[model samples]
Target chain A: MFVRNILSAIIISVAPVSSVLAAGGDTPPIPSQDWSFSGPFGTYDKAALQRGYKIYREVCASCHSMKRVRFRNLEALGYNEDQIKAIAAEYSVEDGPNEDGDMFERAALPSDAFISPFPNDNAAKAANGGAFPPDLSLMTKARANGSNYVHALMTGYKDKLPHGVELSDGQYWNTYFTGNKIAMAPPLMDESISYEDGTIETLDQYAKDISHFLTWAADPYMEERKRTGFKVILFLLIFAGVMYGVKRRIWSNIH
Target chain B: MSNAPREKFDNTVVEWVDSRLPIFTMMKNEYGVFPTPRNFNWFWNFGAIAMFMLITMIATGIVLAMHYTADTKLAFDSVERIMRDVNGGWLIRYIHMNGASFFFIAVYIHIFRGMYYGSYKAPRELLWILGVIIFLLMMATAFIGYVLPWGQMSLWGATVITNLFSAIPFVGESIVTLLWGGFSIDNPTLTRFFALHYLLPFVIVGVVLLHIWALHVTGSNNPLGLEPKSKKDTLPFHPYYTSKDFFGIIVFIIFYAIFIFYMPDALGHPDNYIPANPLVTPPHIVPEWYFLPFYAILRAVTFNMNIYMLAGLGLLAVFMVEFIWRHKPKYLNGFLGFLLLVLGSGLAVFGLLADLNQGWEIPMSAANLAPISAKFGGVLAMFGSIGLLVILPWLDNHPIRSARFRPLFRIFMIIFTISVFILGYAGSQAADKVYFMEFNNTMLAQIFTGFYFMFFLIILPLLSRFEKGRELPKSINEAVLSKAQKAGA
Candidate 1:
């Protein structure tokens, strides 16, 4: 019955409001992709890689939990363990028992998974305002446009509305991400982080790389996916050739 | 001739700096040489100022957010924690709060500067239009950001504004509910507000990029208002403009710092000090100071029957002045231009004065009876602004070629100045309710508002036909510059 009701509502809304919704423009992609990080032919962009790392350190690591990844794993992404440890030690986590036998918080270890700073979901939601900003572990994949949408959204605000909504004195509206207008104030900034890569600190470059890092976090198996795809394609090509030869032999004999 | 050929040498320091810190090289590729006017001017600096505010607000906002709570129950306490407990958190919060005020201040100036200089005209229309877009986004972001603290003003303000959408035809209620995330402004609204507040600055940043790009494409109009003629007429963007913009930024920062540090709450509502109570509404809910002008405009219209007309008229009037005042460039001699300077300055001064004292009592009759009424200063100032702007082209009537004498244009400028002073004086008066009620009509209000609209829409366009030719001086620069300087002084 609920399904029927929902379907009926959708039909009703669409039949009348399609003109309104479709009038402004088509519904944008669910999660937009950032193509800058992934270069032509799926090559990793070095500048994007460095920027991605910077975004991780400056933004994501503050509140979000990447439970599957380790600080030390950054070394594989090309950071030295010393660099990784220095970054990890920036945050203190709860661990060993206190003198009263309660667990105590301490500096995060290179070995530790990226635990959320909040105590629990309730704490997170309470701090953020009743909405537990979801762990962005698989956010890139979960979102519609992959990484591009995130990058574009970061810098997409204008002062005026395209429609009737009136903003208060200090509020701004971003166009790229969902919500038509969003609340997550633009996070990335030019010269916000001191980059090691000598790339000029540009908001675009920063957003692009951070988005790339998030994309990787969401699907750590991206490289594997690409590899598997290539192998399957190669296998299919060889199989097609063999089948063609076999069919020719059979046909020749029959003739 | 071989005294020993001197060994060719490369400066390693220069190379190293170029490789390691290529700020200049990158700048060259993107913006070209220092002072590159290849096109811009003082009007172009606002985007940079806007960018600086975005960064300042975001940084302070994140810090505040770190200490803030989003739940309906604890959101107020969390704001208190920011004010009372966190180290330098109060300062950050206040700066963020006031930074919002200053951001609007800069934007209004930026917008007005665009208006006077014709920054939105022609090829640069997109830039001006994009600026409007940026302004809209800024408003949304600020509104949601204000609500996140969940203070009294945040709550009541949200209720009032959210309820406004219910005026829409049909699905208004549902739309409002969807916006609120519920029937009333509560947990869901707070959450959604936070999510959106967090998001909009990035959008502003995006539009700003487009704004600058549009400006770059249009280049910038010069102080002389004459298009650049040659390579000799242009300069590298670095030392010339970079230095000038840097100077502007410094001066702006000094003022910004005063507000951020000392008078932080001066622009904020006193009611916000109290915690939000959904059941209670503040006695006189007013938006921030930056929005006061528009609020005044909104309040000026007594009848809901003409709401859309009033609103549209007010908005369209903002850009109407430029068109009305627009005249053939050839006819705008130094003397005539000087008159415009005087009128423009007077209008600005009056606007500021009108905005300042919201509740000053004005004496009305022979009995010397003074009573407090809602200030009509904004209305009067706008009235003056409308008159001057709409009839500008007619007032500065000069034929296409005659630049030698600008007596007619000068007379128009004086007329514009006198009208502005009269309108400004009238604007300072409190709205007379006795007169308003006894009249039993909005005819007086309409007369003022209508004249404001008509001057631009009717008078100025009509004046274009009567304008005769004027003779030009040897140069567009010397004739206008000296005159403007004299008028400004």
Candidate 2:
């Protein structure tokens, strides 16, 4: 029994060793970038942001309100502050702190809400059936692949989109919608927004950047987060190297 | 001299980053060595993977719970609002949803690893028991979480499972109402399920810590089922095992990320796409696939067949076998024990496939959808799992002090292999629905389920008799040398 037991043990032990040895023939590749909190942030193109803003102003701003953003905040993304104020002055906003502590109407300050496309909630819903067109302020960060999904939804419309499905006159179809059967119509057009840079002419680019800017608006601190993560990882890596030698020293007597 | 203190501090940070993080140090101090075994194979890394899944679930869940409201009016809309309005909420939700499935995948692998390596044998019994406890808690937590989404599937899954208690003789109605907190599944049920689901993962975490503690006390059982006898038999765990575990975690995370980002909804049920409607029942309700085996067992006991007499007795017998029988190892009757185990596992798999019948889509019409038979496959698979597990100790007939001399045990291993194949075939055959109630022979069916129980309880003690097996090996080296000579000749 002792012999058999010992024999069985050796077989079990040796099989794994051979398997481990066999693994050297098929070396798995390592990822180029080790993703961590410290990994470099994904970069956005500047031209994309300018076009995205135009799309937002022309298409999205009509129905939705970015109540949290100031017109001046646009300058932080490379637009001049003067240009920001000029943009803000175009919108009429509700004001306060008057004799009754509530002034009724004024030109928008840096703190004003973006212009609403519809006159009211009822009008917006009436135009698009009973379903409410959601606010776009944070839509890019609200859903997984929000920018791509939104962009796909905007450009996905086709006549006779699929099967015998009938679309309402104003309602459009998007190929990229989750169920491929969304209620919302295609909202953007190539000629809808004319830009100084001649870039917003593309239907796809317009959809892409509006999505990007919305993403940025939702998580403005993304750049800061990525930078901090990188430094922490660097510090940890250096610390690990020094500790290895210490561990070796501590366990030297065990051998 | 003043530079000495600064140099030391810098050195400490460097060392901590590379080899001596406070976490690692604490683990080392608690575990008492590095790279303790050089040969754990791929299976040992699963515990760490399981840990990673838990951490992922907790992090994503905390973020999701922040935006979620438990009110009846706002619950569904709250989910929609999170999808449309909250920053990064979509990613958080997707990660949490996929994370649950990934956690189960890791736990299943860990359990199978334990089984393959004989990690549950003898001294490591507490580890296995704690693992089972963790598994139970995990199931409870997941069931509760499923209800929180307030989807059609969630409502129906809850309704079906809770209704199972209605099969009880007299007090079943009261018991179910007590469980539901009312006569029907309503706001009280949803509120209670949400609360319990939120509470259960933390309970799992506590149980997991106990699982690891038990594992550490026994150290890890290696693939060879042999204990290390000398310093040459082991290595420090830090650089060796730590690196392997780290690599395993990274690979596991990559797969998890793919599920989180690309195919987040692949594991989800389509019925959940529709909002929860308490008034309407889904065409077919099924629990998550992980719960299918148990569901099958519960259903196998058809109504009108004294469920209390058969199912109640069967479950008690199983509990006693799993827990009480651990103390009396000699009572395990090797061959019949193996058959009983195979039968039980076949029944479990049969249950799983039965639940999956409606989920799969085919291009065929209703006329073509006449139920295909797979009942035989279910019985076989269930029995196969039970067979191998119960007969294992006897199958290793070549005196197992060391793995090197267990060549003759290979014959029994072949038996196990054939049994699994047959069981798998039977399970495939039993996947179709059984709709004939009048012809179903309900009493005879209960007898089969009862036999599945009796096989385990009655036959396990008789396996040792009529077992004049192959001669045992005399020494580890002798066994190895003899094999080598035979190969050469």
Candidate 3:
């Protein structure tokens, strides 16, 4: 009866977890996407990340900002120091007051974070029709379903609306957004961005690449974290075994 | 009087320090040769693991604070900087973040162990109360520390929790303003939370010392819940329990590290990655998992009216008189038992009543909507849950300490634990439309909240008064021997 009670307790306790997850509104589930960094032993695909970086630079950079990342941090994308320096020099950053007591624009350094096109939030919102374009630094982590959600949203824009669904003036219909209507129009198109390495230039390919890049952007140290976890767990298991033996030896004399 | 005698060490340097301060002698007496009950189960290891987690949190927290900024505008950016720029900052930050969850897990198991074996009874009442004080302090520290990140959840969570104070009658608004140090949870609130977040842990440490001091005075209560009668019933604390505790810590850390490294955000709300924006609110807002059971209690239906509800109301009046003459079991059992039976019947009636009321969404008319009074009632329920724990020793007057021997109390405990879990699950989902078993989240919370309160207020007292538990083993040694013989060891 005691064992049965414990079993029932566990079963009853776990029942709510499934229900809680199921209460994610009426939206269709975000289908999982295959990625290089999907499993415990997974590592980032450098080529895909590089292509994804290009997509971010050309497309997303027009509105969204990656303010948390620095050019030097781009080394994670398999970029060399000189290449990072060259990339940093492309963007101009606002610098300190000069002798004339005025802020000046200077060439960005390797340590400088990604520069914003708009000076402030008000300006950013003004340029984007009163809707603030949020930063992309931790976008994947900020949303549920992470990479899959981003990928689906990117490819989910519908030219034909579902029956009885009417969109507002600037709104577009998407299958993934909590509300079917979205503020931003479709951003990806087939053959829109040319690839230097003979990679396919489809809208779906672009969406997947960008999603992968965003995942890496949100969690840069994931591979290192997993690696360290492996070592720590292995050492602990062995140590625990030895401690169990020691405890047995010590208690044997008494009990 | 300088009480205890110093130990004489064979080493001349050790002998000199021992004679002067007796600090070494104190350690020797308290930790080295302290007599501990021999029949302690694996549950006893949680106290040691909790201590290890506390130290881990403090160590990682100090390093995280060195890089963390506490202002509203800069706080989020500073945390991002720690993750990106600082050396091994992600590691330190993740450990500190997940350590709070892990520490709570340890302390919760420790508390449950005490409850199961009746460690809080008799001479150890103060020790149990001190442990509850530590739990409260830990909650305060964890809440304030959560705000240091200044994310969307941090801003909104701090807003929701602090606003709960306004449910009080007169000085409520003033108390809130004082707590915020301004009109809203702004820069001032962030800075003060940071200060208190750092301060409360040290205060918890001081209380923990007192908790341990109290424990040493009374000694430990074992699984058998019997006092040791002879040396054969106990063993020294050092090699015996120390090795056991070390094994527990290592095993516990292996799981801790998995969460830290593999799925660091498993227990976290994803919305927190966004920077704080006071204007925008996330569609769903939930507290940390540790606080969820209380959160569910805080939001449970307070004034919903129906047939079961009306009958329960009539019982409340009779219960008042029963409270006045609680010692008289004749009246106590008749009235209280009838009252509980009525309410207990309603537990399965949730589905039948589901069709009666619409969802619990806001913006309903004042007539049927959750009213202003509901907020105060919710606040009372949430706080009353913790307040009950502080008076738990007084509540259960049973002579038998171990629930192992008390079949009825053990069953009630299982029911109570399941209710808490149900409440936690209900806390996570939307509290409106029916999602499970023809009942909504709010309804689930209400039912479980009834069970949770019933466990303490009715079930414990009545059972403790009347229960004739099974006969116990003669001593701790006998209990251990019987267990070994049963196992064919």
**B4-79, model 3: which lDDT tens digit per residue?**
6555899888889888878778887788889999888899999999999989998988898899998888999999
Rank by DockQ, highest first.
3, 2, 1
Which parts of model 2 have CA positions greater than 4 angstroms off?
Answer: A1-41, A64-124, A137-149, A159-186, A214-255, B1-30, B33-38, B48-108, B142-194, B216-219, B228-489
DockQ for all models: 0.01, 0.03, 0.36
Tens digit per residue, CA lDDT, model 1, B1-489: 113333322677755675666644555644655234323445667766777888898888888878888988888667755654467665677679889988987887786555444445455556766777787788889888888878778987787556655544576578878989977778999998998898888888899889877666667754334455555446666545555555555556666665554344557875665567765555345666655443333334432222222333443343334334453444455555555545544544443333343344643121122121122222233334433533333343423312224344335434543443443333322233225445521234434454554544554344444545354433444444456578979
TM-score, per-candidate, Cα-based: 0.48, 0.54, 0.90
Give the least accurate 10-residue stretch of model 2 chain B, judged by summed lDDT.
B1-10
Tens-digit lDDT track of model 1 for A154-194: 66766667777665543457776434545455577788877
Chain B only, TM-score of each candidate: 0.67, 0.67, 0.89
Deviation in angstroms for B335 in model 3? Answer: 11
Superior candidate under DockQ, 1 versus 3: 3
lDDT of 3: 0.83
RMSD per prediction, one decimal?
A: 25.5, 15.2, 7.0
**How does model 2 score by TM-score?**
0.54
Give each candidate's fraction of reference contacts reproduced. 0.00, 0.00, 0.66
Q: Judged by lDDT against the true structure, how good is candidate 1? A: 0.58
**Model 1 / residue A107 / CA error / Å:** 32
